[model samples]
Target: MRKIIFLSLILIGLGVLLSFRPDRKPLSFPSSRVLPASKKDLQYKTHSVKQSVVHTLLIPASSRFLVTPTLSPELSSLESFVQKHQAIAAINGGFFDPENRKSTSYVMLQGVWVADPKDNKRLMNNLKLRPYLKKILNRTEFRRYRCGQTVRYDITLHSEPSPTGCQLLDALGGGPRVLPELTSVQEGFVDFAKGKVIRDPLGSSQPNARSAIGITSDGSLLVVMVAQKPEAPSNSGLSLPALADFMKTQGVEKAMNLDGGSSSCFYYKGKTVYGKINQQGNQVRRELFSVLVIR
Candidate 1:
């Protein structure tokens, strides 16, 4: 009888212990992080080819329209391809050859331009971005834009997910306009189930934690993000050759890397969606250039 009573008490104690344990639904950082895979996670098939550009999705020749703007042709080349609030840049920037670092992103909407759109900035100052983005404009949100050393931008407005810095899409047609070793870039944006965009920081490891979604007018409106390269933090993951192959496997015909390390940024319409490539913040980055824009 004593043994039975003791066993019952032990079981009760265990139940209580488990009930109070912390939940591990969405894994946290510095601990065990986990990214939830959705239907969007595709297992694409590919053929053996060592080409820089390969078609992932069959773009209807009829649908693939080029951009040529009436204003700065360099501003946008996706001539009449975009609908309302649409623009495509030429030669998107990246971390490939600009080690000298002479680029930053700012925003131009309507006739006004906003620079350094950080989420936490003050709104009262006209020289500041918070007012134009959050207060005066009543825009939902912003963030410092994030992208891989390879993922370049096309163009879209009010499409920025975060409220801080604006991301310039299609800045320079497809890739770095000058001093580049690798060429070709893809542009588009995706949404994260309407919650926020996911960033697979090249510097963080919380498996399945990497993601990004954007409305890609450049590629028939599809969300795009490169899987976290196993060694990006080490500055060794997802090389140009490797990316070409990986993108090929995933049906990415033309893709490019964006500013990596601290310069790498991503944000949903209202939040800085995920971590960054280098994990080191981009605050003190000098000659530091970023894109801050609005619709």
Candidate 2:
């Protein structure tokens, strides 16, 4: 039954690919342009956000959320780190649903990685949303950082149930391959998740009070950043549209939304990106049960 569903999704994806015509072509930017350094050189200065229904974006009106990265100025030093951890060579990011558990602050790190499938088993062994430094030190690839995908989309996955418990996918890749786990968990698809080749349509989600993250195959990064509508409205320092627009501006070919809210956050380049914001504001807490860090 799962095989049947998987096949259907591949066909859908193929159809979408075949039906492709760029709505807008993005202006080219140097793909090699590196991000700003973390400056601190090693450790990350932590920040926080009060858990809330709606989350926010990195740069107001920015699609590209920057990570102050872990670095080794010397290749030998970098190689030493890579030897201990996993690593990937493409751009990716987004939120992840728990392996089987669900919650309000459930958004965890998820994205593409460069590692072995056996590593997947190891990662699942310690899968906790928002894991800590020591906890994250597992599955090191060549001593650097393990580069397995935050969200594992193997052939074994099945239907993604809606919030009300209805399966969206009727079929998937047919044989042993798994679908990408494409789902809205539907309140419905938001804006950022939509495609805009040139950033005009720069898709951003409709600002969910809660959300998570995930990555696709198109070399794009998604930040399922969310901001909850409070029981009583107050200053929520986060924003969107600009982030989605920034993503487009950054030349991401495709993007989308995920589960987030207080759960939204990322770790890369040695520094944590925007910290979690729940109801109040930035709240610094470590090890969120489950977090997908890019090694």
Candidate 3:
């Protein structure tokens, strides 16, 4: 009888101890897989927040990045780009119009304009978009500059000139720079006055699947894709501001939002993850006009 009573008391004590134990689930940083994979120079991580899962690929400076458009006239899937390049990792890039099958975002490869929005008839000829044309044309982009053996990555407006003596190796247009401050109004993603939003083309304030790229303080390239979490009360994904905040928390210094919504995706090590999921819980796969790949 004494042994049974002692065991019961011990079990009660353990229950009390377990109840007071601190929960580690709410940490902002990813709690798992911090180290690089075997024989790989890049690190792929998945961080979960309230209503979204952010997929991140961190690539060191030694690895090369290539931003290019699909060779075929039609847009290509993220998997196709990865397979074609035999890339270490890849993320969808730029923006495009499906109706006309023309790129709305600029794409420069090998210092030449591979995909130019100026050539998009619908965009240039639209009377409604005439007022915002200039800003849209000069949206932020991811660029690479090379001087001698030194190569650098940057997130800047399309109009920003490359550093003198440095060749513009590649560039992939996306937009409204998120870090160093969000450029929603300047980039034409939003129109606001008196603290009230008058127009928002990209639904800047709403939660939705988003893709963004940035350069960490250490100069590492960070590609991120925010996916919807269906089980959560709000499974829409992260808003532009939320994404910017998350990136800043992750040590991203300069960042730019990519073509998100249904277009957001990431591919690495023979696996692909889509960002947007429909109300019926189906993944929305979009063919992209361009992609940024690491090799």
Give the TM-score of each candidate: 0.28, 0.30, 0.83
Per-residue alpha-carbon lDDT of candidate 2 for residues 1-295, written as tens digits (9 for 90 to 100): 9998999999999877866658745466865447664422222222233433322222211222222122221212222333344532111122222343222111112222222222334344545422321222221111111124221121122232222322222111111111132222211222234463322111223332322322234422333333333342344423334334333433433333322344344434443333334455444232232222233
User: For candidate 1, lDDT tens digit of each residue in 36-138?
Assistant: 4333332222222322111122222234223221122123211222222243221112221133222123333232343323322333343633322332232
lDDT of 3 by residue, 1-295 (tens): 9999999999999988877778824336764587545432677889986588899987876654543334334878888888888886888888888888899988888878888899999999999899899988999999888887888889898889988889998888888899989988888458778989999988788899999999988788888999997654245699888999999988999999998999989888889999988877878898877888877
- Ten residues in a row with the worst lDDT in model 3? 64-73
With candidate 2 superimposed using the best TM-score fit, by how many Å does residue 268's alpha carbon deviate from the native? 2.5
Clashes of 3: 0
Candidate RMSDs in Å, in order, are: 19.8, 23.8, 11.4
Better of 1 and 3 by lDDT: 3
Question: Which runs in model 2 stand beyond 4 Å of their true positions?
Answer: 1-233, 237-243, 278-281, 284-290
In model 3, the Cα lDDT at residue 117 comes to 94
For TM-score, the strongest prediction is 3
In the predicted model 3, the residue pairs found to clash are none
How close to the true structure is residue 229 of candidate 2, measured as C-alpha lDDT? Answer: 35
